[model samples]
Target: MSKMPTPPTLPTATVRPILDMNAYDGQVSAKADQGNDLLMRRTRNVGAASVLFYRDPIEMVSASGCWMTASDGTNYLDFYNNVPSVGHCHPQVVSAMADQAARLNINSRYLHQTTETYLDRLKATFPDHLENVVLTCSGSEANDLALRTAQRGTGARGIIVTECAYHGNTATVTDISPSAFKRGKLPDHVVSVPAPGKLAYGDDIAGGFADAIVKAIAVLSDRGHGIAALIVDSIFSSDGVFSNPRGFLRLAVAVVHRAGGVFIADEVQPGFGRTGDAFWGFLRHDVTPDIVSMGKPMGNGFPMAGIAVRPELLAAFCEDVGYFNTFAASPVAAATGLAVLDVIRDENLLANAMICGKYLREGLQHLADIDGRISDIRGAGLFLGVDLSPNGAPEDANGQLVGDVINAMRRHRVLIGAAGKYGETLKIRPPLCLRQSEVDFFIEALGKSLRECG
Candidate 1:
């Protein structure tokens, strides 16, 4: 037999990596020379596009519940992962995945009762109108398919998204994601609008967003590419976790419909009851979306994602081209999805998120009260953002402060990340199973890091 051909490799820096902190040219760590040597070997083998967290990236070996153990035998409280929504490596999810994989892990082509059961339970969590669902292997595929459906259904090519929004990584979806582009330029068919201002309106948050969409629609219509859909991350997560002014999304949804366009809710980040009050993030806004894309936490870190749509919207797309995925909605995926839902309800994770989230926010608020560098704190449930600044003024926009805090927290054995256009907002989204004690631990670490950075 002929030898298998080796895969071609792309040169370093050819593709800008995610969360690449190349500007920070510093030593990995003074404590662990062995770990730093391993990191050097990893960079050479894993290619330049592999992004790692912290100034001295950790080598995590395993995790369970709200804690992860690094290769250096350090236990770190995980407050940066949302994919393990129910908690990392929960017994229920692990058992389901293992049991199903051992039994039958076939494709969707086969008629399986497990898939039907999982779909039935999944559909029950959503509104009645969002009854049709098409499963995909990843959120990128779901968003890509949703985009195609919107354009075909509305007979238009124009799309509108938040100025710094990121939906996914597919080629087509990337055009609509201004945050993903290093140059920050969107395609002609796509229009970007500023995200809901943090202090825009305490009670009328929907008005500004609606007005922006109205203007975008008019401009796209004038340019001959009529509006197709307006998509947003329900929590406005990347735009700095703007979840205030409940039900503010109603006006935007209405405006999209008025302009003969669809509204798509990208719930890949905020779904699975992470936002505390509801099962889906879009529900908190008191609006119905034409289509909703989900992933990440759906299978509790498994590669399962899907788009739930109104039957009418799905019908139109099906008429043109039907969706099919070999590994999507497979036996193993169905089992994993079912297990996640079971754990969320039986373990009462939503209630835990609400209680612990409030506790965490109050703790953060206390820190903000004493420190001027803590500019603003906002968000819903476990998905919160803490804005950092040197002078504590709104105009500071010091990305370095946020970066320093991240590195400091990592050194303290607490994992976290940052968000927003300038990457100045600390993104605190731990596993939904976070407890009161864990919340206190994180707060202490954060306070210490804040002081050190100051």
Candidate 2:
């Protein structure tokens, strides 16, 4: 038999591969899919990059609201997807897209009323200083542009990111995303700091996190890559949803600004009222970002994203090269985006998120009281993270236990995923239209899943 490779020594809080968390083993999946034609065909189609959830991946045919219907007709309560933030296949958004496509769906090169109207509505949600909006097709493209703009504005090559941050998959952005690194180390220009959490920063999270940024700035300076930007997901979603101590980001952001670095709030995960307390996650910290890259739920899964940037930064970047996306800011995209915004306001989804989020947290806390395995519960609004530990100790958190519980939850017909550096935190992010009954159902399923895992 071939010798098993020795696992590398990891820190107490190690950086786990983002894509591998709660992901199925390819070799095992291949063996399991021996007789399954669909699964085998999928493997043949996508090959090695085919990353599917669960050991036994379900073929989903249709979805609505918070539930996904599998091919076998079983309904799975979706707690994993955040793409359809306003709820899956919302009628208003679908109608807007279809109508616009039928009427006129031209590129941004031509002036369109719907495009400008959508920009006006979207721009109103951001700070006044962020006067320029550059549309893109995905969060990756948005972030790539933000990075280039930051570099151009500051004339620096360095970036600071959270230890396990997953900004995007673009070649340039990937260099700064530690979680995306499967084997190689981060590029020299990009520096990573421990996530701003109680474990890393103790009592004074704000000060400690800022101090780390200062150190990162110095390191980048020493390497001749002066600070360009401190880009982060304000909620720290990939770093395990660390959304406590409200304004903890203020000090860190100030530190970055002092070092001549711009602040880019990568809101691909936390934007569009998902956090409930504020329209954007950065708003909760009261720190104005030089650039804000948003996607995922922007068009409610319609594949539209953009960056809200300070006018000066955009101007500076534009001086050297022009920026335009052929498919972005189209009449169809604008209409779809407008519909999402209208739904958010008309349906009072933000208020619902706050109400439902509080209820969800309370239920999780109640579960924690009964089950000592649940070590901690963190986050705000609808985006929460539950840490699972063996023997009721945070330091002894077990990813294996978390994986088992996730599988158990799947067996109970509730879909969920994992997060955190150790893959020990349950990443719970349902749609904004989550109701009291759905929260109750999730809580009950979780309790049962915990019991089953035990």
Candidate 3:
């Protein structure tokens, strides 16, 4: 990754789980006054699992570039969304999707030129060894397929994941996401390890991660579930955004390979040009994963995701079990994917991310220098985190500061989110096309929010 500016380190406190609306003390009726009745009716009709962000959810009507216009005509600077990697509703992507939909949208069974062209372009973004791809409509499905492929290819059932890691929402994937477990328990076939942290491991972060994976592999094998795959969110977004010491993932990947387990990189958040240095987050670590699952920004908010795998691994799985998705790899999805690539290259968003990200981080670091609560700030490119803690202790503050800061930012019309095991980190991942002026606005808003919250 590019050596962007980094704030000084402090002990990172585990953030709380995602916010629960029921537990929120904010006035629910307030939203109803602001025309949330329709939303509430839809919410009631929708599945109970469907959740909305903010105490008063954003009834977003339109978005452009890095700003979202809410129902009440309030424009919020988007700093928490990566779904629109190129930017919200890019003209090229919208036009491509519309044109492709008007022309033809068909399944992969029938040969399609757009599908072939899209896949070729996507595969070109990956390493030479990762030549095959299986398309899915969502990241959850892609991750599920990658997991199944791992077991089929390696003939092992065990999986290793970082504690508090969230790969996807599927049944099998939920088992590996330690935070998603109902009772803080894991399945027999899965094991959780601490993600690379500054406090627990001290200087040898990579060694610590490698050792944990090795131990997890042994434990899984001894427990009769032989190691099949060790998967991770390359950015460690859920585990408080640990993206320092580039190439740290190589050590753990080597251990996984030695143990006959595939290293699967869940690049849902860090893929595309968000990482600035490279197209994929795994490449930042200089490690080649056997299976790389990507989503979120693939089609620039067009519900497209897929897994790129080594031909040998995918070939063996396909030989025994064929795969197909009804809406995946459709012509419309191909056009959207192609358009996303075009925007990234044509607009030079990667370089923008690098420059803007450095400016943002430096501004954040200046804030940290002035405020003790802004304990640690780390990550690369446009995806970054600001770890907040009380007295700089890891065990303090359940999300009071973070929640205050986030809500305060909302009041300031700058959108951002919280993450980590106490929700103490501000997860600032704006669209890759964010400019220097917008970065300055975000920094100014963040500073004011911090001061007001304090």
Candidate 4:
């Protein structure tokens, strides 16, 4: 057998100043106006115009490489999206889709080898225990399956999840996700725990988060049976991309299992090489889960999601009832997922994500000296977070400051995003193909934005 050959080294290019800064600024203004005009006249969301007052929602016309061109013909740096894992419209994936579509694009019910092959390829990325896989049309569906499977396997109804975790948008998933649905009204059968905040908790994430879960499980067990499972976003992507004490998940999962609950790692955001050090974000903690829900980057912008369960747990789920999604593991979706995996392995994007993430973290940290608004920096690989606390304190009133920074960054031709209940954290989950130049530009833009906001 031959060892896999190494990928060729990355090439560097110079950014020529052919276009003036004013030229770009004028384009951005025109683009904003155009977007506003169209959205106000044409589109509506919840009976409101597409213009959300947070600036005109970008009518992205097309994207390729690391840039997105809006309907107004102005380009913005694509740094806020993690769904385009291999870069926007990566040629390899695009070509694969075109080739496979011409050849065979069928449903899972059809007899095609690609679906099984793609499933096998995906399975190889997981541990041996997580052998059985169930594909779904989206993360919300994957999570819904995960919840149902966990309940059947554990015979428990209580679910413990991160306080700010955003698993998906379906009814069952929304019940588990308090950040979006349970806000202002607490969720039943759910125990929410705070996300890792170093300054607030003295960096003792393992102690704090674990204690919360332990107490909840004990309370639930005392009242009835134990928790059905504990669901969490491995990187807490929506909760400001938290990366902390490496072994925290290991401890938490053990506790949940000891309490007779399934350990579900929701890798919707950090799966597919976004975490770099491991193929899956939870793997970084050296912990295997009873149920692993994957989405977002799995198909690299396609609506493909899945859950890989421990064989025993899956057996329990299978015995309970027959469950199938119409589009789950469809040939086209499977091909898209397989192509994404190929790009990750062939291009060595895992290592790239880690290297580039470190570069971004260091660059952002350096700006803390220039602008104190950037209070905290945390994450692993391309998943990152920037807290807008004045002195790295958790309760600082920089919520509006963070919003101002995001809007200001838009003016600088860099599109980023913010998260956290207070909306005070810059959630920087760029596609794994992000390069150092883009990171540098983000840092400069962010620093300037912070200064201007002050």
Give the top-scoring candidate (lDDT): 2
Angstrom error of the Cα, residue 226, model 4: value is: 2.5
**Tens-digit lDDT string for candidate 4 (1-454):** 2222323332332111111111123234555656466554544333321223244456778998678897878888877778888989988887777787888776677877889999888888899998899888899999999999999888888898766678887888888776665225545677777776664456677777777789889877776756999988888876667777677777778888888898899988888888789888888888878899988877778888989998887788888795777777877787778888898999899999989989988898788656655667788888887887644445553455666777888888788776675666787877778888888888888877776776
Question: Which residue pairs collide, candidate 1?
Answer: none
Q: Write the per-residue lDDT of candidate 3 for residues 1-454, one digit (tens) a residue.
A: 2222333454444434554411233255454545657665656677465567776667889999999999899999999989999999999999999998998988878888888998999999998999898999999999999999999999999999988788888998888887665455898999999879876588899999899998999999899999999999999988879997999989999999998999999999999989798888999999979999999999989999999999888888889987999999999999999999989999998898889989999999888877777778899999998887755555453566787788888899999887777777788899998988999999899889977965
Prediction 2 global C-alpha lDDT: 0.91
Worst 10 residues of 1 by lDDT: 9-18
**TM-score per candidate:** 0.92, 0.97, 0.93, 0.88
lDDT of 2 by residue, 1-454 (tens): 2222323333364547988888878687666688889888888999889888987888999999999999999999999899999999998999999999999988899999999999999999999999999999999999999999999999999999999899899999899889888898999999999999888989899999999999999999999999999999989998889998999999999999988999999999999999999989999999989999999999999999999999999999999996999999999999999999999999998898899999999999988888877889999899999998766677666677788999999988899999888898999999999999999999999999988877
Which pairs of residues have clashing backbones in candidate 2?
none
Score candidate 1 by TM-score against the native: 0.92
Model 4 pairs whose backbones collide? none
Q: Residue 125 lDDT in model 1?
A: 90
What do the candidate models score in CA lDDT, each in turn? 0.85, 0.91, 0.85, 0.76
lDDT of 3: 0.85
